[model samples]
Target chain A: MAEGSFQYITLAASLPHLGALFSNADLPMSRYRLEERLSMLEDEDRRRLDRIAHVTSWPGVDGCDTDAEVVARFEAASRSVQAHPDLAAVVRERLETRMLVAALRLRRDGAADPAPVAAWGRTAIARAIRTNWSEPTFGLGRARPWLRAARALCAAGDHIGLERAVLTEVYRQIDRAADDHQFDFEAVAFFVMRFQLIERWQRYDATRARGRLEALLQSTLAGAWTAGNATPTGAGMAGSLSQ
Target chain B: MTDLVLVLGWFGLFAPVALGAIGSSIGCARAGSAAIGAMLDTETGYGRFIGASLMPSSQVIYGIVIMFSLQRDPMTAEAAAGVFGVGVLAGVALLYVGIRQGEVLASAIVAAKAKPEIFGISLAPAAVLEGFAVFALVFALVLSGSIPG
Candidate 1:
């Protein structure tokens, strides 16, 4: 065969292999089933699977070649998965377990480094626990662990970790209040503002602080005006803070 | 008879001042309620805001003094009646202005609560109300002298 024709045939053959690999990797399955299937793949196919997994995993590649390049890669991977529907569960479960273990290891070793990466790990783990765990079974006694982990990361000057924890708690409180149909706008606003202020303080810069405050005021005013609520009386608890 | 006219004239001159006091009291109450509303979420530093709301009533007190001054003088029946009518008009105006001013003060308190940085801006409208009350009080003083023997 001519050199060009040989190259074409090789490429065409690889496409099917790639499709099989994508399907086997992207499919969702129980954590154990995923591990079992991954163990069964041939070495070369497993290597390809690893490359795709790393590409799609948390804190995925940044500063890509171009938007088109990124989209093409994602689309190809997705298309490959679509061609082999049976592998979906295994792919998903493997990714989830891998992420959970990586996050846990990072948390365990985070105390020594206390770097941004460690902070990210802590946050990821907290999120995983929340998503995978629920009330009465896994959630009841787990809050303290997450809080402790977050606090440790924060003490290490992990702004991202602190922010993640603060935001998560704030959202949890908001959700709870919403579910209960209790309107505590003032309390919510106050706590949220305090969290924002703390974040600003951690990332200390005078100009940025002023800008944030100005933006907060503008947003607050806009929110009130849009809601058609009573304009806040200047005499309220937040009066001093406003000043 | 002149003494009686003077006494009546004094009463007329003071009537508006009394009306103003009533108005101020109402205004103060409304302003207090608004301040309370603003302070509900954050209970600190409410005392100062409450004090500011009470500031407008000083003019009402002044109107009362003018009316008392007229009572001490002697005047004719015609002068007394004229002064009395003016006093009534001034009192009615003071009352109306006071209540409206209270509303403005309430708004100011709310503003202060929300934006302590801009609380000063809220004071302007309340000041305007105070200005009108002062104007009414001045009118009462002027009319007090017109009471008959």
Candidate 2:
């Protein structure tokens, strides 16, 4: 009967169900529609949702210069959303999942030992990764069944597969949290998080990225040749550089 | 003492209607909000959602019936206790069932919006709750017959 509960129920009901990850290539709802529904959230809850999104979403962390900086942002964001324990756990779980993937990547890159727990700031997951660095799944295959597939994908250098597997796991995590919340702030957060994954996955186009990369390489080579030929005019190489 | 008893008798006579109305209002509000929200997400079936939300409104009508059933010739201390017990308890049942029905109906509306095929079946739980409200109503009516006029 409280005002906030009514608003949450409305917001929740307005959101169309996002089916299982990869079930739909297109998003169930548009960003504009989602933001409009989200407008009903209380100011404080809205702030928390923003913080959580910034810490977890790709666009939110685009400016971070280092892994440690990303972890610091996650910590702050997670702390801000502490009022919702499920969402808070979600933030932590996301950070740990990413850290685990990073660990797997490190192993694939020929690292002799696991990265220190300080960088990842997930002591439990980090320690597991450290102790089971030689193990294919980092000894977490039981709980996180996707770990084995993720490790295999990392080993095979299947960036796309790894991305899909990791996103699927993250999506599953958000989905699990959603089971406990229907018409509350936590439910809204879970909905937004899952929507983000769906949007991100739909946006992913490996072929387009590869094409763009090749075009950039050609342009850079052409710029280098032009700079080399400009020697007749006594132009400095640095000056002739296209960048 | 007799005056207090007479006042209680009158309070009992109207309690079912008052309490049931409160419950129905809250239940209908909860379900109706969900229905309105679902309407924003779907293209059709607005009527079904609205109908589902009205399911809780039956509580108020049941309350009214109980009010009529518990009506006696005149307010008397002898029958005050019996009427109070039956009227208040029935009202409480209606109130509780009404609110719970609203919660379930809201959930049902939201779910049925997602998978339209389940709309009819999703209402089973709410129907069960309506059965509970009827139980309270029928029993209150049957019990009212035994109260001394």
Candidate 3:
């Protein structure tokens, strides 16, 4: 291990529980079960989760009937998580993505306030996103493509489709970096982001997810064929036909 | 003069084991930490994780082989210098590559835990580093033969 490198420890302490901490449970008593699991995490992680729980309580997501209140709680939780440097980067990116999606949906419906989406303007996330454009490990490359997709989706009034597109891209990023198995901060960060996306998709709209996933798969295969990289074979043809 | 020859020969005999062991120790420690973390996330793959953790230990084996090859009767100053040079340099190479391979394996283990499909592909980088260690081992063996016994 490199001197002064406690990166693996940080990752080990944090990554496994991200899905449980942020996921919206569908099962009966799952929230209580998740809370029990959260309690068992090491102190550093437990503190971060406690902060998020407090924010969630302020305008309890289920208690909030309006979309505006839900967005507010998201912002508040995102804001509070920043005090813990270890959790800040991933939390910020997650919140910004949700905010951007909410903003696009609201704007499409001619809502008066786009303020929630613009919340990132004053945050450190904006600076990080600006600085690290090509870095998939740091969650930098996601912002630009997400914004572009958000614009196109909002124009089409496909509000629910935002998550599927974002998640598809997240999965693709994970695939691209799957071979980057170095035990550094970057590798762990990528894992955390990938885990978060997997959990996010678990509760997303299934019909939209299937449609977007199929489209993504087609485009990817089409790209392979167009680039003359796809092996011309019976199996390839059959695979394409099955899809 | 005779003392100098014996001294250098002693250094040559132990250099590979010392350096190679250091490298392997660091590598195993790094990769082992990752294996423990991966185990925490998922169960029933302990065997593969343990196998991956042993990748760095190969460098030390190479070091031991080179040490045996460098052993010569009636050690002379000229032969000892050749042995010392080949042994120390090759040991250093093995050491460096082992540590690097460990880091790569650690990453591979964590990445594989998240996406098991990439497990085979993730091992490529570590295997490439191991190739470097093999190159060092082969060169040391070949150079040992050239030294006049």
Candidate 4:
């Protein structure tokens, strides 16, 4: 078989696996059609798309491909979804899960430099969270289960996992605040700063992460002026400190 | 007559500031409520609250400028009087703007309190309202300064 043809076949085969990874109670197979019309492209284009599948599925499987090459393929896939808005959500969800799983595996393998892949995972998770949260039709009340799974997945990793855990806790706090009808400007500010910190850490910008952490702490102090029912816990305090 | 006009102008200019200050106080209080909501429930976005808090000061600054302009040209009683009238009108308009802005800020606070995650996208419109008020104040200041004898 020709290299190009082989790549197409591999991508075809991997689609099912990708689809399976994203499958669960929340996202049923009906919601995500893995067998939909695959993009017909030139052999070179097919090869490029295949690289994304390869990187996300098995980054260690050597193809002498650079990170830029992988990122390009992923970006292209991202763009493709944009062009076909109907397919955007499912494709993004599948791709994010694949990247997250790959990053987890890399961390498990004790890769000397897993930062980049882990960062990608963190970004993908953040996007997923935002997307899920923004769906007005879905309603915020129904977000807890999916959020829990995503949070757990994030918590299972290393340093990145810890950051994700803190973020998840913050989101939980926000949820609790809403339920109790005690939403205050100061607490909201703290969460926004927390989100910024995680975002900085995801980009491997330690300086920004540290700065955001300090800002979050300062905001917490300033938040004392509001004085609501929710007690700032030691865990919450520690999480900000670690950031 | 010039002193009266000058006084009127100062009053007009400061009126907006007073209204803006009240608006800001309300906005800040609304934000506080949202923050409390966030603390009690899930996390709410505070950026909107902070933005609302910052918005009212623009009117206050406009009032200060108008007062200064009137004081600077007190000798030109006719010009000062004319400027003062315009300033008063602007201040009244600004007062209305401030009150409306405060209400919008309050609504945003409610939304933020309900869903903190949406904060990244929700603050855009409220900011736009605040921007309009700022523009009005700026225009008033410019107009106040350009009044001729």
Candidate 5:
């Protein structure tokens, strides 16, 4: 695309704002602390992030407190990006992987059947979307191998390893997508996503990484009572490269 | 007839200036945006940023030199044609190089902002574009000597 074209300009303008959206979700920091950190960014950067956040946030969804609600929030965000099919696919893939891992964790902890894990919402439907028959084998199948890795990590009680595996996988796809489509708008989006991912990953204190892993496992073990906790703090593998 | 030769000679004399100026303006402007964006991310290193942005400005200087070299007291039709051909082609070449070089500089600025240590390395591509512009300038200057005055 020409540099000054609408699509190119829009993609360029949207890139800096992604800093906030994809920032490592593995941290347990408070929203206020996140806001304080954001305040230090350039005015243009701050404004763009705020504007995108405002647009994407649902009207009545005040603080998603359950796995179902969190999934809903992700779905809403994914739909918001539907104007760009490649981005929508990338985002949807990320959400699906998270859902898969969370379900596997629930199954490992107590739940015998994974089908009704989120009866309050259409978790089954979301799963179906992720495992659709029409998609590429290696692309969608990549998540399955990661799912197996997550299960193995859970079996071994390797919380840190699980976090590292899942997050790295999520960004692996994004980074690959970016590299594969170097000249497209999706490449810019992928680069920005990867940037945000790295920012968040770096910000997490390496020394306290184990404690964070314990926190994640503890919340997972708490079952439905603690499922909502994962929503705020986020649950995933991060900083695998750091280790 | 004499007036036409003078007119053609004047056009040849100024062609590089017009084309090179357009290129420099566009290139510098493009690079300036990236430099300005990067300066916001760092407090120091403003000097390097400014220096990078001015990379395209050299095209205009080349244009000016070519304009002066093309000037002659008794300009002939053949000489005027030679002047117009060399000056205009060189100007056009410089114009393209300047704009492309600016884009390269802009990308370098973006990358350097992300990782400050890559500042020097990021300039490599822009230097190559500048080399192409230099090649055009040198050839124009050398060829001007052969044109009948």
Candidate 6:
């Protein structure tokens, strides 16, 4: 639908509430069903939404062979979502967030400076990160408060904590955009983005992790199952990975 | 001036019904769309949603009543003034209330769908809007009695 013609009361109302982040263990609706509902959108709108998703979701950039390719795809996606101001803001924040988190990870991994990380982020932040390489928040802590806590999480060797903090910040950004819209394309786009986050969170469930481990075990261990498998494994890889 | 007053008399005579219809239609359509959308997500309680969507229709009913109360057997300059004042003002009130009522009802429906327990309390705002429309209707009828027929 056109921007102003988006009377999506029915469309938005049809979708169930996604509640707070990490509040629900499972998605209110499945990806397939959500896609079916979203098919009601015009082709142009759907394409715009896809572009927005490409910038924010991991799978959107999964096929890129190099960082430059990813950056190029991100630029294109950012342009496509410009028509939606709220969503444009969301895309912008997501990019900055990804840059900030990546910088954190690289620094944690013993990168000496932000010079290499500067190649992929915005111009404004490239200078800040590069100049503040020795600073804990890279001198943008006040502007980006989440970065301070995120930096602390990285230093404390809490990768899972860092992941949680990053996801929460991203979720809040989308949630803020969502508050301005109720029955429009922006609402749908925000809903889909939040759904992706919820799905990712659910995938971090212990049951799902156990299932994945079993599948891997069946392949590598040749389906071997000892009776001791029923006993406590003392916090296996699945335990730490479960959200 | 007399002819203009007579023309306004006719305009005022029909204003309530016409304006009310406009308001009701807008309100009903807004809430009705929300109700339909809510139905897709829900299995039961369709009746309540449909019923809530009809809340805006009362604006038209009040408009019709105002029209009847403002009716004069033979339009005159003196009666024309009161008719125009009461009927037009009443119509404007209904129109505004109807549109606002629709918006609130739509919000109520959406909120209630998320939390069903709030459905009853959610209608409170729309009900209060109905009270305002009734106030316009009641006073217009009272004032219509004083017009020089």
**lDDT for A216 (candidate 4):** 87
Name the regions of candidate 1 deviating beyond 4 angstroms: A1-243, B1-11, B72-75
Compare candidates 1 and 5 on TM-score and give the better one: 5
lDDT of 1 by residue, A1-243 (tens): 122122222221111111111122332223353344345344544454554454443333355554344434544443454433323222333333333333344445543332323222333433545554322212323543445555455447676565555445433443343232111222222222233333333344445678778877776666655554554553333432465
Candidate 4, residues B13-99: lDDT per residue as tens digits? Answer: 456556556655554544443334333333343454556545545556665665565454344655656655666676665566555
For candidate 4, the docking band is: incorrect
Off by over 4 Å in 4: A1-243, B1-3, B43-54
Off by over 4 Å in 2: A1-4, A206-243
The candidate maximizing DockQ is: 2
lDDT by candidate, in order shown: 0.51, 0.86, 0.64, 0.46, 0.65, 0.84
lDDT of 3 by residue, A37-156 (tens): 344345664454555544423233667776555656667666665643433544444555555555455556776543444444554554454343333322533545666765676678
| Candidate rank order under DockQ | 2, 6, 5, 3, 4, 1
Q: For model 6, what is the alpha-carbon lDDT of residue B131?
A: 97
Q: In candidate 6, what are the lDDT values of residues A97-118, reduced to their tens digit?
A: 8778878888888998666865
Judging by lDDT against the true structure, name the best candidate: 2
Give the TM-scores of the predictions, in the order they appear.
Answer: 0.36, 0.88, 0.56, 0.34, 0.60, 0.87
Model 5 chain B poorest ten-residue lDDT run: B34-43
User: Which digits, one per residue and each the tens of the lDDT, describe model 3 over residues B43-142?
Assistant: 6677787689789999999999999888888788778889888888988898898888878888788777767789889999999999888888888888
> Over the stretch B20-43, how does candidate 1's per-residue lDDT look in tens digits?
888788778767765554554344
DockQ of 4: 0.01
Q: Docking quality tier of candidate 1?
A: incorrect
Question: How far off is model 3, as Cα RMSD?
Answer: 14.4
Candidate 6 CAPRI-style tier: medium
